[model samples]
Target: MESDESVSDSTRPVDSGVTRLAYHNGSWINADDVCLSSRDPAVTQAVTAVERVRAYNGRLFELDRHLDRWQRTTKALDLTGLPSRPSLSRLIDEAIARNGAWLARQKEFGVLWFATPGTADSPTLVIDLYPIDSALIERRTRSGSLLVVTSVQQPPSACWSRNIKVRCRLHYYLADREARQTDSDAIGILVDSDGTVTESSIANLLIVEAGGVVCPPSDQILSGVSLQVVRELASEIGITWREQRISRERLAAAEEVLLTGTSCGIWFANSIDRSPLRAAGPVYQRLRSAFEGRVG
Candidate 1:
C-alpha cells in the first residue's frame, strides 16, 4: 500500500490515478496537507517565483536548465532565505520518488515548483505536482490553432528577474482570457513596449521566411527550454535559424509560423490576426518529427 503522502484519500480507483507531493519549509508532506496562511506576503501581494518542468517517459526533460533558471529568479527577487540548490534538489528528488508510480502510468506530465517569501518577510517554499491535462496536449499536438490578440508592452529583459521563471503572471493570464474570448487556441502574440513582435504569451514565436527560420532574440523573450531544443534540432537537420526583430507584417507574410514551449512542444500557427497559411508545411513536419524523436 502507498503511504498517505504519496496518494490523496479523495483519489478514486476509477478516476485515473494521480500522485501528490508537497514540500514546505523543511518538511515534505502530502499535497493536501500543504497549506498557506492568508498573512503570507506572496498571498497578499503576489511575491513569488515559479518554474514548470515537463516530464517525458517518466523523466524530467532539461531539469538542470530549469533549476538554473529557478535559482536565478529567486535570488534576483532577494528570496535566498529559501533552501539552497542542494536542498531544493533533494526535495525534487523526493517529489519524483513519491510520484514515480503515477508518472509511470501517465507517460507524460508536468511538475510545478515555486517559492514565496513568508508572512514575516523570511524565506519559505511551496512545491507540488499535478497531472497535465492529457486532452489538451493531444489537441495541440494533432491540430494547430490561431492566437488572436495584442502584444504585451514590457521588454523581456526589463522584467525584475528577466532570466528566471517567476510566478507573477497576471499579464499572461489576461492575454489568455482575451484569446479565449475570440475562440482562439492560445494568446495570439506579444509585443515589446515599442510594438515589435516579441513572442506568444507562453511560447516563443518563430517565423519561416524565404531566408530561413527566424526567432526573436533571447533579449526580448523568455529563454524557453523547448525553444533551445528546437533550435538544436533545426541545426542538426540542416535548417537555417536566426534571431532578429520581426514585425507584425512580417509574421503575417511568413510562409509558416509556430510556437514552442514546455507544454505545447511544437505547434504550427495557421494564421495570425486571421491571416491564413499552410497548417502543416514541410518545415513544420520535419522539425516536429525531429523534436519527437529526441524526446521519445
Candidate 2:
C-alpha cells in the first residue's frame, strides 16, 4: 500500500502562478484577503448557513441540487435580504470563472457558499473555492476509515429541520476531538438518544445489510447530497436501497459500512469502535466504480 505521506505531494495542485479569487458580498477579491468583521453575527454566534459543491473538470457537479438546499436553508432560518436565486446562481458562476486557473490545476475541487445574518438589516454571503484533500481521500479509499462512536448525541428534530445545512457544528468539533483521544485518525460517529447511529462528524453513514443499502431515515440525519447521488446510482444499477434506524448492533453486523459526504464521496469503514468489519466489500466496489464513472 502507498503511504499517505508519499501520496500527499502528488495529489496537491501545482502552483498555478495566479492569485485565486473569492466572492465576497458583491465583489470579487483575493481569496486570502476576504474576511468578515469581528462583530458580525456569523463570527460571534456561528450563525451561518453553508453549502458545498464539487467541481469535476472545472465544472460544478450537482450544482442545482446544492443551490436548492442552500435556498431552503436560508428560508428555514428566516434569513432576510438574501440575493434572488438567479442572482446567487450567476454569482456562483462568476466565482468559478474567476478562479478557473487555480481549479484547472487539480482534477477536482470544492466550492463553498456561506450565508449569515449580519449585524445589520441585510444578510452576508461569501463564496470560496478549496482544494480537495487528496492524501486523506487516497488513504481512506485504500484502507477504509476507522470510526469511534462518540458520546455526543445528534440534536433532536424539534431543534431544527434535519435537512438544513448550517455552521452550528460545535458538537461535531467536540465529537472529533473526543475520537482523536482514542485514535488520531479515527472519525467520531454520532448516535441518537436511543443509541441509533445517526452520522459522523462530517459524513453520512450507510450500511449494507443482506445485500441491500440502508441508511438512517432522513428525519434522523442530514439529507446528504452525496448520499442522494448514491441512492440514484444504486437504483440505476438495480441495487435495493432503503432507510431505517441502524442500531449499534446492526452496524457491527452489517455486511459492509460506508461513509458518504461532499468532500470524500463514498468510502467504506474498516472498523467502528475498534472492531473490524468488511473492507471494500463487493457492493462498495460496484457503487464506487459507478460513482467514479458518473463523476467523469
Candidate 3:
C-alpha cells in the first residue's frame, strides 16, 4: 500500500510533458479551461453530434471529407453557431499549430469536433486535439482484438439516418460493459434488430471472404470515410470490395473481420464470440499498409 502523501504527490502535475488546446464557438483556449453547461441539451438530452479526424505526422488526413460530413450533420441536426467548413479546417490547423509540442511528440494525433443542439439563444461548438496513445494502437495491431456479440441491438437506421454520429450512446455503453464481463480489453459488436451485423460500438465493421471484402450497406451503417478510402485503395490494388448487407451468419463465416475508424485506421479481430476469425493476414496487411502509406 502507498502512503496518502505519496498518492497525493503523485496526483499533482509534474512535468506532464503534453500540451493540449481546445476550440469553441470561434476561438482557441486551453483544453482544461473549456466547459459545457450542465443544462445544455447536448449534455442533458444527449443531442450532441461529433466528427473526429486525424493528424498524421503533423498533417490532417482527409480534412475536406470529415468536414463535409460535419456539414451534413449540422444541417440534418439543426445545429447553430458552428463555423463554416473553411473556418473549421483553419481552426483545426490552428489547434495543431498552437499545440506544437504535443504535435512534435506524436506521429499521430486526433482532432475531434463537437456540435451541440443548443438553445434558441446559443449553440455550442468545440474542437480538441490530443495524442493517440501508441501503446493502445500497438496492442490492437500486434495481436488483433477479441469481440463479443451482445443482446443490445443497434438502434435501427430506418428510424434515423445511421450517417449521423451522436453522443447519445447508453446502449453502446451497456454493450461494452457486457463485453468487459468476458474480457477486460474485449469490445462489443452490435447486431441490428433484424439479426444483421451492423457495426461495433464505436467503429465500423468489415469482414473478408473468398470473394473479397464485404461490408454492410451504408443504408444499414455509417459510410465511414476510412472505409471508403480503404475500398478505393483496394480497387487501386485490384482487390475487390463491395457493400452488401452482412448477416450475423455471414460474419461468423468470414475468414477475417476488421474494424475501421480514423484514429484506428485498420485493425483486425482475432475472434468474435469465441468463433475464430483469421488474425491479421496478408489482406489485412496489404490494406493496412495502403492506408498508412497514404496518410503516414
- Strongest candidate by TM-score: 2
In candidate 3, what are the lDDT values of residues 1-296, reduced to their tens digit?
Answer: 01112111011222346746688777677676777888889878888888877666667778788877888778888886677788777787787778787566655567777888665577888888655656777777768888888777888766667887777677777777888798876788777888877777657899889848998888888878888788888898877888887887787788788888775678889888877545687778888889878876
lDDT-superior candidate, 2 or 3:
2
> What lDDT is reached at residue 102 by model 1?
61
- Residue-wise C-alpha lDDT for candidate 1, range 1-296, written one tens digit per residue: 12111111112222244546577787777666776788876778877788877777777888888888887788787886777789778888787788666666654566677788887667678776656656666666667667664745554465464456765666666666666676645555667776778765567889898747999887777888889999999999999999998888888888888889877678778667766535677788889999889889
Assess every candidate by TM-score.
Answer: 0.86, 0.91, 0.89
Over 4 Å off, model 1 = 1-19, 100-107, 159-161
Relative to the true structure, candidate 2 reaches a TM of 0.91
In model 2, how large is the Cα lDDT of residue 172? 78
The global C-alpha lDDT for each of the candidates, from Candidate 1 onward, is 0.71, 0.81, 0.74
lDDT of 2 by residue, 73-100 (tens): 9988888788888998898888887876
Sort by lDDT, best first: what order? 2, 3, 1
**Regions more than 4 Å wrong, model 3:** 1-19
Model 1 TM-score (2 dp)? 0.86
User: How far does residue 193 in candidate 3 sit from its true spot (Å)?
Assistant: 1.1
